[model samples]
Target: MTRSATLDVLIVGGGIAGLGLAGYLARQGCEPTVVEQATEWRSSGYGIGLWSDGLAVLDELDCLGAVRQRAADPNRIEIRATGGERLRQTTIPPDRTLLLAVHRADLHAALRTAVPADWIRMGTTPARIRERRGGVDVTFDDGRTETFDLVVGADGIHSTVREQCFTEWTLRDLDTYVWSLWVEEDVDVGGDMVSVWGPGSEGFVARVGDRVGVNLAARLESAPEPPALDELRTLADAVDWQRPALLEETDEEPFFDRVREVTCERWRTDRVALVGDAAHALHPIAGMGASLALQDARVLAQELATTRPERVSTALDRFEARRRKPVEREKRKARVEAAVTFVESEPLRRLRNGVVEHTPILDLFVRQQAISG
Candidate 1:
């Protein structure tokens, strides 16, 4: 088959992982084309807790200030029980200089704005998957074929690239599902994030922007029946700490959902590899997927920039090895919480919630800064 324009690298998916890789590669002077299945990217999802690790990657890529200006709220978080009983409270990391509670759309918009429009090809996906002489050749849905020195699947879970590149393997599913909702803040719920544990489920709620309060619910095992908006309202109403003032102002609620950390057996192959959710889609309950994904993107970039192009496969293996440990540990932590929060034992559930309510470490868990090259 005849090949089209050559690329130093072809990155799939235009989400944070894909854009982050393209941005860093562009800075390194490598030609990269980011292909997204979606015609237009949207940041309408919930807010992500961008920790120092992810921030450091953004810093190196020269977009940290925009992130800070748009996302960082004053560092403070609270842990509580069903009512307003304060379990634990702390000023978020003082040394990190800043922490963020930015909305999903704002961050996406910021990243998209920084990338050259030509480097991003929206509404495109890889087609006619086959390994070739230099690397891989892909014909797109548009009937365009292109070759690259390297192919990175940043497309996310259910990645077609992953299915085509690797032998069949199991993606172990963790018995948890996450539901997130955004509502206008009615009252001040403090500057800190709030995480609450209940029987058979856990909740994380925080005010990120001027009027947005994001709530996340993670339930263990098989997912429950279909839920409606009122369930979250009921759950939010259940929290009386802020009471009338808080409930009065909250309006225009929207809900989004996902499965928890469903682990895959591996992350790379010759001339091809996975990054971000495509490779290591961790539990959002950990609030670390974005940060971790940014770290993975930077790691892939550092390896590519520093290593010879022919060593791409080796670099991918090393990247996977470097990230697998941290990802596993965090996954295990989330699993433990899932077990406690979703257990049939009522007393055990209460105690777990009790500790989160009182535990100062709630705000200290995810570290998001990038490693220097």
Candidate 2:
């Protein structure tokens, strides 16, 4: 492949990671083609808490104002036990700790508005990707073939690009299932993010925009192929606070999935690269997935823009090197959090609760995780 003045980039998956990278690359004068499998924009009907890092990325993309208009500012976080015993409470100052709880659809819409409309190809997917010496030859599901200077697999955990390029990648099941949903009702948590922990299960409730968002997680022996709402309801029964209202709002089909972490030996191969969940799918318990995805977009865009098109491989290597350490650190923290939140042992749970109640560990953890670098 001959060197070009501008890099022609192809991004798979049009979700947060793909769209965010597209937005950054576009701002750098790179016209990136984004292919999304969905025919239309899908609303997740769930909320995500974006820390300062995520907000900074949106601000750089000039989408922060729009996101703020659709987001809620939770002033604090409250952690409690199954019997409604307060374990820890941490205050989140807007100036100090920037945490915005926004609906997933709203955040996606903000990112979508940042990119060129024509750049996104809906209902499209790549059928084959062949990496030649110069560029990657991609065959789309619609039988269209295109060659680009760079191909990015920002397509979440089960990325086709990663599957094709990095065959050694594996997904580690966390032996947990999560259910999340949003309801149009008031949840009086005093404008705070409330988390209720029980044996082998946990629940979260927060006021997002004008709706109440609820997330429930439970530890299981094996992955449930078809998760039943009744089983989720049974887990909800284990908790007292926020049970009745959350159960009342639970739909027949809420967002349900098994929690899995993506582990890969490498994030790049020649000109093909992986970003976001495609490279490292951290457990949602860390609340860093979206933020890290945004960070990946920014770093990868910077590296590619600064490097010559002929040195695209070097840029990708730098992108991976810059992201690997922090991502791995967060993954470890998420695993620890999962253990504490879903511990089944009575004595261990008591010890964890006692430590949280007495020390500033929760506050320090939140603050530490909120920092981007």
Candidate 3:
């Protein structure tokens, strides 16, 4: 049954960012209702890396055990030159388990499984929201209205809330577009995870349970593929698959994703606030998009946990202040990483690889990740 017209929180978006913050808030003595644009909850997207920082959030939510059981460590990462000239291997050591590569759906399922179904109403979306002295009034697509003490915008890169609150800031296009698909193969991929090389192309594949999940994307100027999975699969196949030619002779219905980095100037407006990808979507090449989302949820919840119900926005402001720096730092890292990408020269690649392998730079980079960890 629905509670009173007023609630402590109304979360917009049912993706990981939304559901996670909702779950975390619910555990923090706040009743949160989640509104998802999707008709029903389903995990039908490409895979993502669940790094240690995000896993720390899952650990708090008590949902980590479920995700851990269904995921693989994929601790071994193999990087090979396009001509097979040099190979570099990196491993997550016994003392430090850096991340677990997981499908987006599985991560979503694990997070949702812990939240009460009644708290989340699928197919509910906000048409408009008004903030007054008492609270915020939220209007839904079904012509219904509800008031809440606070609203959390976890809607993603194209957040409608951001449009409403702080639309003045421009989300600059990074001159690069990304796409991915999940493929299955009977044979092992030689390494647990492989980042293959090609001229102006790069891709990675890891064993997601029994099936193999692959994600590939290159710089595209125009509409590279139709905004659908089947069409994007064609684009996925168009890229250079330098990963030992496993999919060259297979017919599979693979999951696909078209990616773009989301940047924004404003994250909080009055009583309603943005978190996770809604606040900022970083470039996917950094492999930290999912990590950032999870971190946003975790930090936002921590800030709210200690504040009174009436002071939620103040907590959100705190969340914005603490998050902006670390997130911007990662964005800068992604820009540098994406600018060079896999297209540069062999000498350049060797120079970059050698720096990562033989110098303290890589260790410092790892320590930066440890900041969030």
Each candidate structure's TM-score, on Cα atoms with residue i matched to residue i, is 0.85, 0.95, 0.87
Measured with C-alpha atoms, the lDDT of residue 211 in candidate 2 is: 76
Q: What does candidate 3's lDDT look like per residue over 1-373, in tens digits?
A: 2222124788899888887887777776667888888897765676787767888888888888888776767656776545433356666575666777788888899888767888887787888988886788999999999998888888887787777766655555654544455556676666787766544556777887777777665555555454444434444454434333545534554454455667677688668888887777877777788778878888887787767656766777899999999899888888886766656466776676665556555445455665664
lDDT of 1 by residue, 1-373 (tens): 1121123688889888888888877777676888899988764676677766778788887777777676745466666665656677767456655457777777777777668998888888987677665677888999998777788888887787887887645555655555555556455665467665544545666665555455546443444555545455555565445533454555544545656344567787778888887776766665677877888888877777765656677777888888888777766765654565454466775776667666644555432222211
Q: Which residue runs does candidate 2 get wrong by more than 4 Å?
A: 1-5, 225-227, 250-252
Worst 10 residues of 3 by lDDT: 235-244
Best by lDDT: 2
Q: List the residue pairs that clash in candidate 3.
A: 43-105, 262-281
Residues 188-287 of candidate 2: C-alpha lDDT, one tens digit per residue: 7543688899889888888776778888888988666655677777788887777666778646467888888999999998899999999999888888
> Best candidate, TM-score-wise?
2
User: What's model 2's TM-score?
Assistant: 0.95
Clashes of each: 14, 0, 2
Q: What is candidate 2's CA lDDT for residue 82? A: 87
Candidate 1, run of 10 with poorest lDDT: 364-373
Which scores better on lDDT, 1 or 3? 3
Candidate 3: residue 291 Cα off by (Å): 1.7
Give the clash count for model 2.
0
